[model samples]
Target: MPSLITPVMPPGSLNASAQPTLTIDDLLVRPWLGSDAAAVARVFQEPMIQYWHLRKADSEDEAREWIEQWRLGWESESACHWAVVNADDDRLLGRVSLQSIIMVGGQAEISYWTAPESRGKGVCSRAVARVSSWALNEAGFNRIELSHSTTNIASCRIAEKTGFALEGTRRRALLHADGWHDMHLHARIGEA
Candidate 1:
């Protein structure tokens, strides 16, 4: 698949041998495009991703179709989905999204999943911290929220590392493959 997350700089005008721009804070969080469908879809097939996002994406054809829908969502301002790319090789590291945006309420939630190979390397924590800071400092958001199944200890750790306060649990909030599962809700509010 072609690159989905490129530096925010003007495309098609980059200099040769340029350092790979990684993300928003040395990371480059940008949208998934047509060519990214295959790779991004493969992520969905991972067992961990399926548990969190709840879809295996089955095949590249399905991923392509999802990308089409994603284009519509982006143009309509319904979502801000981005692929996490490495600063060196520009390889996709993972994906992140600003889901359920509420303009009038000045609120949004962030969700992300790192590639299986990228787990346990502080990638998700760094991404969450950087994005949370942006939500408060750059985006002027009053609140940001994220949730995970109670069994997901790793994600809970990521929340803690990123400064997300444990708000509470919503019993039976998530219906995972194992059946109805409780979810721990977490939130971070900007200084108002």
Candidate 2:
């Protein structure tokens, strides 16, 4: 039953230590805190966020549960979510995550959302770049993918800015509230 290539990264590579707190200028990309529940809820209420991300927190409790799931994701190696906060004020600015992680394959999919006021200020892209670099160079991931609705021009720009090359378009790949939408798949491969 074990006649195959070795796992690119063994289990516990991520859970063996504390989730890293990454920094870029005034921004701190750290693990989600329970106190961030309210801020997380508020951001999900944004029309654009809901339209694209396809979920709303609805309440602080629900947000807390989501935060807990992200915490558990670190141990499970299924996902990693970081809350992007301003170092000076500790205000929530955005989120970046690696979803559908596969340690044996050393791969994951990147997802992100920025608060309304933080948009157009370079926060999301900077955080994404930092996190993606960490995942590729530090965390032993061999490839990280980013996909967005084809119509999401802003997301397309962010993916390109973070060095994720356009792979291809997946027809009707994702289902949002409106309907099924074609998605553009972008990816960055790492030496690890």
Candidate 3:
């Protein structure tokens, strides 16, 4: 089947040598590396991460596969995933992704997670804000959407802190291990 999604950036804009590395406060958002598998597996073991993301990498090999999938997403122009790391020590904090991109419509969905050790430090919030700005101003997207299970109060706070306005709720929109969840939608749009 022909692909429906178009590239967010023009051809050659995201070549290997030109991939972006965004710095936000003390965080560095960059492409994932093979050496990050161990840290990725460790983060996946966190209960909150497992609960929301609903996937885990039990071994470094599995984590590598996950990284490979993100790489493929970039190649296919379907998504852009960044490893959120501490700029001071280059420690992996978590991940933030722009997925469900509709280049023709200049829209995409943002998703993110915080590492167990990085929680409560505002890492995710800063990362989201920086990325959202880049998506709007640099990536040329007009609107970015975020959604979280209504039970995820922490995520709701991050969305609000990052300037995403509350949109509405979708009944039974997501199926987690605990069953269907009501999802709250939020969005950030570019200036007129």
Best candidate according to lDDT: 2
Q: Global CA lDDT of candidate 2, please?
A: 0.95
- Tens-digit lDDT string for candidate 1 (68-122): 7755554544445667777666677787766776544546678889988888877
- Candidate 1 stretches greater than 4 Å from native: 1-26
| Order of quality (TM-score) | 2, 3, 1
Best by TM-score: 2
C-alpha positional error of residue 87 in candidate 2 after TM-score superposition, expressed in Å: 0.8
* lDDT on C-alpha atoms for all candidate structures: 0.72, 0.95, 0.88
Clashing pairs in 1: 22-27, 22-28, 23-26, 23-27, 23-28, 24-28
Higher-ranked by TM-score: 2 or 3? 2
Over 25-133, each residue of candidate 2 has an lDDT whose tens digit, in order, gives: 9999999999999999999989999999878889999999999999999989899999999999999999999999999999999999999999999999999999999
Each model's TM-score, in the order given?
0.81, 0.98, 0.91
As a TM-score, model 3 comes out at 0.91
RMSD, each candidate, Å? 9.3, 0.8, 2.9
Clashes of each: 6, 0, 0
